[model samples]
Target: MLTYQSSQDISITPTKGQDKPWLLLLLCCFWLIPGLVGHDPWKPDENVSMAIISYFMRHSDWTVASIAGVPQFSQAPLYFWVATLFVNALSWFGVAAHDAARLSTGFWMAVGLWGVGLAGRELFGRRNGRLSVVILLGCLGLPLWGHHISPAVVLLAGFAWYVYALALALKQPLRAGVLLACVFIVLLTGASWADALFAVLFAIFLFVFPQWRKFSYLITLITAILIAIPIAALWGYSLKANSSELFQTWWRYYAWGPFGGARSFAVGTSVGFLPTLLIWFAWPALPLAAWSVYLFRKELWQPHWQLLISALFFKSLFIMLATQQSEALVLPLLVPLVLLASGGVDELRRGAAAALNWFSLVTLGLAALVIWLIWIGLVTGMPLTLVDYFARFSPADVHWKGWGFVFALLVTLVWGRVLFRKQPLGRRALTNWTSGLTLVIGLLVGLFQTWIDVGKSYRPVAESLSAFMDGKHAQCIDVSTIAKDPTAALVYFTDLALDARPDNECLFVIRQTASKESATPEVLWSGHRLGDQKEIFSLYRR
Candidate 1:
């Protein structure tokens, strides 16, 4: 590792050997486990995951990606298989299907945190590694997207492990090869081949960098690729053998079209606005990552800077050229940025660090209090000021004082204890920030999980639609205008027959619209989640 100028005074705290990795593990658990379960499949992503997993559990189809008996766009499904494995394993212990499926997030997020911490330790020192993990855990965007069902999270794990394997490639060839094998397996199997291509690109770019331009690194990459080949090939062979047509469809997914079919572009409005998205989503880490570069302006060519900066630059280019954006696409960039920012923590001016730490403590401390107060209003309906605001989410009939309350209360107390403790010097500010972020998420999910679910989930609508169907002879229903979120939820939660055959003798149609429209025949059902304004569903009999 290249030592920083004026290193003695600014370094984190000497070269501590291990830095209590177990503590980091415990923090990861705290950070990862909270919002994993205890709620129904919510909105676009989780509902889609539940639909796919539910189908897989019943049919055990290894080669095809079908949801509700309809084919999916991207066919490579190593990620879904991992989640299925988790669901199957957890079912023996009687866990709910959706909850079990969500456990996959915790498992992969842990893998990511492990890789991130190890890379920090490898490239810098133990303290910096732990600090890196802390800073990442504290980032505003991670907790929001990390705990959900998305291939982006799995790709995140791959990136974290990729960097670690890259760090160890030349020196610890054997271990690095094993880690890189896992990374490739992750990139190859579970997610989109489009996103995985960048991992491979990053690896190739490493060869072009001075640090990775060594015979041993080349050997390590080849070994890992060789290890990953048989597994990927097996998946391909199975899919091809199962049905040649299915394999063809899977192969042409993004190659033929950006989002599963031929399309000019993908989701999000524009690629140009991505940096703006990164501004909030990447949070404190993004700025610190830039600060790391500024601090070492003279050492841009150093091996560490070159590796980190090149990774960032390549991912930036990939994000722009890919023509799609989300919190997920922004995720891989964090690994390099956090690793880069890990060193910046130490070099931060003492006064600035102190001011930032106190500011975090005060802001987070107040935020926690407000969360508790809002939670209290949710339970007792006291503090009438908040009651009106909370009503927008949940009905007045919704009231709870369950075990989640006790759990959240304990968490808030723990956060409070940490906040009021003696002021921290260097790394403690990050600790406080991450803890506060976790606390805020915990309080919201624990206290008002019911409230949020009431608004976000399509369970109520699905159940109502199912009841409406049961009242009459079961018949195929038209789903011409229904959005994907409700569509997936209905498929997962109900037994209604959904189809889009306009010529069929279907009497019922389910359509979503911005404003309710009058149907000539008697309407079956018309409603939406109370807080959702983007869509309202109406079931009509034509």
Candidate 2:
């Protein structure tokens, strides 16, 4: 039978020791990989979010809707307020709206990565922390979701860090109370019911766990409530004033309908391994995590495991329970998975006999394969069959090029060196090299795709619209058929105030057919044709 040693028996000192140079290299890579992927502002949700931020920035009235002109109470306004500050600050430096949005996304994403690394270091050792950073940087879904100015991903990242800090607080007294207070303040200001529910569950887990029934736990709990009250009140005021419709819509969506239908086991449970693999990339990690839980079930029965498990369960359950579900919702759950996977790594490291080492090698090899597949699909384009199906609707051609192939080869080679090197470098060195390579290569690919190629497509349209609005002194502009005409982009890019009653003022009608017989606004400006149609603008003085 296999025997295990207690935590006290194991040497606390890391095998590789401190590696500052490697840690810096890993951090740089973490920033670069996600930064390079470039921003794809495709979702309407993104546009809506930006508009909300713009409104708040321009009016300084969190309680009133000056831009979208509709009462908006779908969710809490704390994220919008924070994003608004960034937009307002950047505008003072003469940055354009789109650039501001991208910068904001990039900033939050970096913060999230930092939190991931810090949390990893605290829970696991330095080696596992470095490995966690690499895994997060290489995650495709994370970067993709980060591009949209959604609070969900950011909130998830922030909440995960808070939970990590909370765990530490349970162990330490005075310092823990302060950290716990901070966490409560942030969560309450965000006012996401999801966060609140998770916090309550976490408190209960601490209460039930034998190890956490200490004075510090009680102190932290009391401080958390005290810190939360004011923030919650502010959020409540904002909701009551600006977004009643949003609240109603959200409730209806989640309470009963298709969203509810999707959550049912019949649909959600059916989402098998393929979609999971595509989303997470490290598919085997899930099983490894489960195995680790079984191995360390006793440790998990204590407060630390209870905290991590409760956070994971509540986040997943809330998301799955939602009427509206998307792949993005699962991104938050990845944090706990990363922590659990680190535990698996720890188990493997502790039992580093020949068999376990071979298993680690195989796991790393599988991870490399997934990374290569992602690089090929993202940079070079998909197979001919996939291209044929998807290319028809896409704005650009779908074809693999030689440069992308070369880039992929380079990445594979670098990864191969890190993995297959005969002279066994310690875990720290391996993690640094792997993470650094991922960051540098990933950023290069992203910059080429986003800043050079894809960015060009929208720049001209945004520029022309901005110029037209400024030249004509058009304060009141109304857009029809916004989805096809890029009107929403124009509105956001120009920071133009949306007219609540466009029919009562001078209106700029986009995409309407011009006929001599028709009685409407005269043509003000027209530009580049998309597909078989040209984007036309008509100015009408009402």
- How many pairs of residues collide in each model? 3, 8
Instruction: Give the number of colliding residue pairs in candidate 1.
Output: 3
TM-score of 2: 0.69
lDDT per residue, candidate 1, 1-542, as tens digits?
43333374344344455345576676677678788887788866888777777777778566665654566654357667888899899999998777787788878888888889888877775566677788889887788677787666887888888988887876787889888887887776765656555666677777777767888878887888889867767876887898887667666655322344333335333667668877877777887888888988887887777778888888777776555455677788899989888877777778877887877878877887887777666567787777877676766344456877776787787777766544336577777888888788777777777777777778888887788778663787877457666777888898777764445556788878787666555667887776766578888787
Misplaced by over 4 Å in model 2 are 1-18, 24-45, 63-67, 88-97, 125-127, 238-285, 349-447, 450-459, 462-475, 480-487, 495-542
Return the lDDT, model 1, position 362: 83
Give lDDT tens digits, candidate 2, residues 19-64: 3446446444444444322343444466566666666766756753
Clashing pairs in 2: 36-446, 71-243, 72-242, 72-243, 73-243, 73-247, 74-246, 259-323
Clashing pairs in 1: 78-189, 78-190, 79-190
Candidate 2 positional error at 203, Å: 2.0
